[model samples]
Target: MRRRLLLSYVSLVVFVLLALELPLGLSFANAERRRLTSDAQHDAFAIAVRTDLELTPGSIRGSTALRAMLSKFAARTHDEITILDSGGHVVAATAGGPALGADLSANPAVQVALRGDDATREIEASGDDILNVAVPLIAGRDVGGIVLVGVDLSGLSHRITSNWLRLLVLGGIVLAVVLLVSLLLAQSFTRPLHELQRAAKRLGDGDLGARVKVPEDPAELRELAESFNATAEHLATLLRSQQSFIADASHQLRTPLTALQFRLENLEDDAPEHRDDVGGARREVVRLSQLVDGLLKLARAEQAAPPRTDVDLRAVAEDRCAAWWPLAADHQVTLETDVPIVAVRS
Candidate 1:
């Protein structure tokens, strides 16, 4: 049962940390990705505004004439490059073939430029996310077409994954540390309890001397140990008293019983003339029997323990006085009791 409880506590901690860390860490990572994507879109729009263009049928941002300029601007940005014309055809693309000269006017991002409005979109296409933004080439208020630039999101995804891995690692380390500390603490607290268990088991096996080791200070655990020790002492005392009672009873009765036996033997063997000595011997035997009875009562005193009921001290004192009243009248002896009715103390 204790093992189950320990496991439950550890499991609860693990689940709680996972529940809190997973979403919080992911949200933070996603927010950063979104910010990066937004920045890429804006950068693409600015690049479109600055580019030199012609309605001449040419590669988009891929034109040999503008490649140097586009490369110069897009270099080190991790942004995918693209150029769109007034007819909304992709004239150039920095990524592989399928992306080149693709019609983008129908695209939600291009539709905004077609309506003469600047627009941007962060989209997943060809198993990759692209943040695309478009701007019309305004050659003196006459729009030649649109210059569209695309930014790839692979790096963002990579960063988010890396951050998540770090968080998971940190969580694992923290959990391990917490569990180790908890185990150590539990052992410290449960050691005394284990000791108590052993003592009780021994006591149950008829070992009355079995006792807990109690500390001097009266802390809770110490007090419990002391109580158990006290119980053991009391039990040992009772057992010893019982043993002494048996031995003392035999000792006290043996002499009288022996005398009785001897007198019986003499009465059976002697003639009628011996009857007088037999009668005196029988009287001595009776006196011995009375002494034996008194000794028996004294032997039984070993079994006496503190009574649960409260006894009236004054009543006991008065009873003692009454017993001596006749002696007091004859010899004028008196007994007094001024002690309180208090329990015995060490």
Candidate 2:
């Protein structure tokens, strides 16, 4: 039960954390991507501003300076920069191992930039994600080359992973704390129930004094404990009263029966012919005395006096059979005794 309760608490916490953190993590990733993309677009436009001469057709002198500027910008921004001619051919690039002179017209962003539109796209390259931003170079309403900047998602992915890891660690700590608290609470709750169960068992086993300590908090459980103790005490008092009354009545009745037997004996001496009637009355008085003695024994037994010795049922049965043998013979009935020597509680 404790394990189940603990699991229930942990599961609820995990579910809530996941529900909150999953969307939050995704939003954080997307926001970071947009911010990075905006910065890249700004950088691309800045580069395009300085590359007007390079973008002009047949401008050879500015090409060397443009390459140097692109290199510096790429190094500062950690982004790959490429300059494409109006024909969609890569003319200059900041990245090493460049695809110089490569026909980029097939790419959607390059085609859009060629048509004088700024374009941005996310694409997969070499098993990694890359963000491509294309800024068109406009030369007084005439189309010029395009400036394309590509940013790898590795850094973004790393930052996102780092954030998720931090959240995971924090969530783990919270769950641990919650688990500890749940365990402590479960112990607090079940401890009282365990005590109550033990007290009930003892009470059922005739230990009327057994009781459980009531908890202070959770008023309902406290009331229940109090009620149980009260009921046990009441039952004990009632049973004790009943046993005492039976014992007292049996003891008091024995005195009158003895006196009546004495009077009968005196009457028997005074009247000899009525001897049979007196004998029968005397026998009845003796039976009544025996019955009263049995009642007193039962009352004492009900009082639960601690046993001092074990009784053998086989010996007791044999003695009872022997004692009743004469009466059985007079009634023409057989009295049998076939019991094993079993020790019985007194």
Candidate 3:
């Protein structure tokens, strides 16, 4: 039963940890993803300001300086870059694609750019996030083109997932520590309980001396130990009382019975035909009287409430000894008193 309880407690701890960890780690990942997305959008907005007039790929023609700068920008950011012309066609793309004549008018970002709306659109294209920012390029008072940028979620989400695994590892470490501590505490508590159980079983099987070893730790366990000791103490006391009662009852009846036996032995042997019958009657009478006295004493001890008196048991023994002194002298038997000075059982 104790083992089951321990398992239950540990299970509850695990369940709660899972309940807390799953959602918390997922939220952390999502928060990081949001930060990544916002940073990507901000970078796209910056590009839009710089490319407000031409689809010249943030540079003039295929300038080596422009290519190097673009390469550096790609190396430093997670956002994907693309340029579109006034015809709503892709003029250039960072993914090494011919963006020169690809129609972009039907694209939501192109529509936003043509309408002179600085707009943004997020779409999933082939499992990649296309965060299109349609900021119209203005040439003197007219729109020239649109600059579109995309940020892929797969890579950023992978990073978020990596950090999540790390969090789970830390949580596992914490859970291990908790379990170890619980184990030590449970052993400390259950050991005493197990001992008490064994002791109780022993007492039930008539070993009244059985007792639990008191625990030193945990106040409650110590209290249980004390309670067990008290129970054993009471049981021993009751058992001793029963033994003393039996011994007293037997010893009390022995005296008069021996006397009656002696009287029976002294009956005449030379009597007539009626001698055997008369002798039997007298012997039965003596035996019956002794039995009656023993029964009466037993009945008195078993009463719902016994009489209480200040009778000194040893003093009573001494008085009985005095009464039998003359008889002991006649039989050449010595009378002696070896009673203790202190009080004793009745």
TM-score to native of every candidate shown: 0.65, 0.77, 0.65
| TM-score, candidate number 1 | 0.65
Who wins the lDDT comparison?
A: 2
Residue pairs whose backbone atoms clash in candidate 3: 52-137, 52-138, 90-99
Off by over 4 Å in 1: 4-12, 52-65, 95-101, 136-143, 215-219, 257-346
lDDT of 3 by residue, 61-179 (tens): 33344345445556788456766666777655665544556787887877978877776777788767666666677665566766666666677668878877887897789778877
Superior by lDDT: candidate 1 or candidate 2: 2
Q: How many residue pairs clash per model? A: 4, 0, 3
Model 3 TM-score on a 0 to 1 scale = 0.65
Clash pairs (backbone) in predicted model 2: none
Measure candidate 2: CA RMSD: 5.2
- Global local distance difference test of model 1: 0.69
Deviation in Å, model 2, residue 277 alpha carbon: 17
Model 3 score (lDDT): 0.69
lDDT of 2 at 240: 87
Score each candidate by Cα lDDT.
Answer: 0.69, 0.85, 0.69
Clashing pairs in 1: 60-91, 60-92, 86-145, 90-101
